[model samples]
Target: MTTNNGRAFTAPQLEGAVWKKSSYSGDSQGQCVEVAALTFAPFAGMRAIRDSKNPDGPALVFPESSITGFLADLADGKFGN
Candidate 1:
């Protein structure tokens, strides 16, 4: 399925999966998101993040390479806050 951002990744049935709020999330209108990895489904890749409030909504899945680049830029403070 596709998310609002056009991300076509499978959304896991996280009825019992553990979810974690981002460290960046704060008391700013609850924009916090959560993520959890699956065990049996391997095609979903290594990482998955989704809106914490909407458990059945869309999720954005990124490839390892793309995530690396994004994290590198983030570490360098390349993105504007």
Candidate 2:
């Protein structure tokens, strides 16, 4: 099992995992990110993120709590323009 602390995963480690982009991701063909929920043991409740343009590339894994905090900060505009 991979650690849920932004560890990068190899191609073989992501086999069979389904990835989906954000709903707000427009069809501008610009930069977009994809996330896959880990539902199996040892990785369940976690999320794997990657660049939509690089399907076979590495993915950053994070725990569910971390994702929640990130979303909260995003909603709060913590990373301002």
Candidate 3:
């Protein structure tokens, strides 16, 4: 029952999903993105990301594990801030 395929899902498909923005974004005029963990069937264990300023816009969905690795890389400064 695993759905870790590498694909992106649309934001419209994520209706009712509870999206959250990072606290670090903090009043940056909506320049940050928001993330949500899909809890429902067919999409559970997946993560969705979207622009805070364009909630109605498209979203990039990924497997939870992928998002986890991405966060880890971010913490490791792999992208070099």
Candidate 4:
């Protein structure tokens, strides 16, 4: 996979991946995000995020630490409304 802006990436293939959306993803239907864990070699322990509206589109891969920090910050309200 190729990295983009240190947070997003483009994988050549992602077969067998099981994508899941957040529980907070309401019934907006067309607007939501999905995440999948890459447990294969070279990408093991990494997390992949994408727009649920486009499952076949590219995904943004991030290290597990990055995902943790992002969620922590979100919970702490670091990103003001």
Full-model lDDT for every candidate = 0.60, 0.85, 0.81, 0.78
Cα lDDT tens digits for candidate 2, 1-81: 649499998656877778899888888777899999988766778888999988889998899899999999999999996
* lDDT (10s digit) by residue, model 4, range 1-81: 444334655545666667899888888786889988888766678888888988877888888889899999999999997
- The C-alpha local distance difference test score for the whole of candidate 2 amounts to 0.85
Residue 55 lDDT in candidate 1: 63
Q: Of 2 and 3, which scores higher on TM-score?
A: 2
- Give one digit per residue, the lDDT tens place, for model 1 in 1-81: 332232545354434455677788875658778766533344244445788777678666555556668789999999878
TM-score (C-alpha) between model 3 and the true structure: 0.81
Model 3 score (lDDT): 0.81
> In terms of TM-score, which candidate is strongest?
2
* Candidate with better TM-score, 1 vs 2: 2
The Cα error of candidate 1 at residue 59, in Å, is 1.0
Report the Cα lDDT for residue 39, model 1: 36
For residues 1-81, could you state the per-residue lDDT of candidate 3 as single tens digits? 434454555666678899999899987675898999989877888888888998888777788888899889999999997
How many residue pairs clash (N, CA or C atoms closer than 3 angstroms) in each of the candidate models, in the order given?
0, 0, 0, 0
Candidate 1's TM-score reads 0.60
Which portions of model 1 miss their true places by more than 4 Å?
A: 1-6, 9-17, 26-29
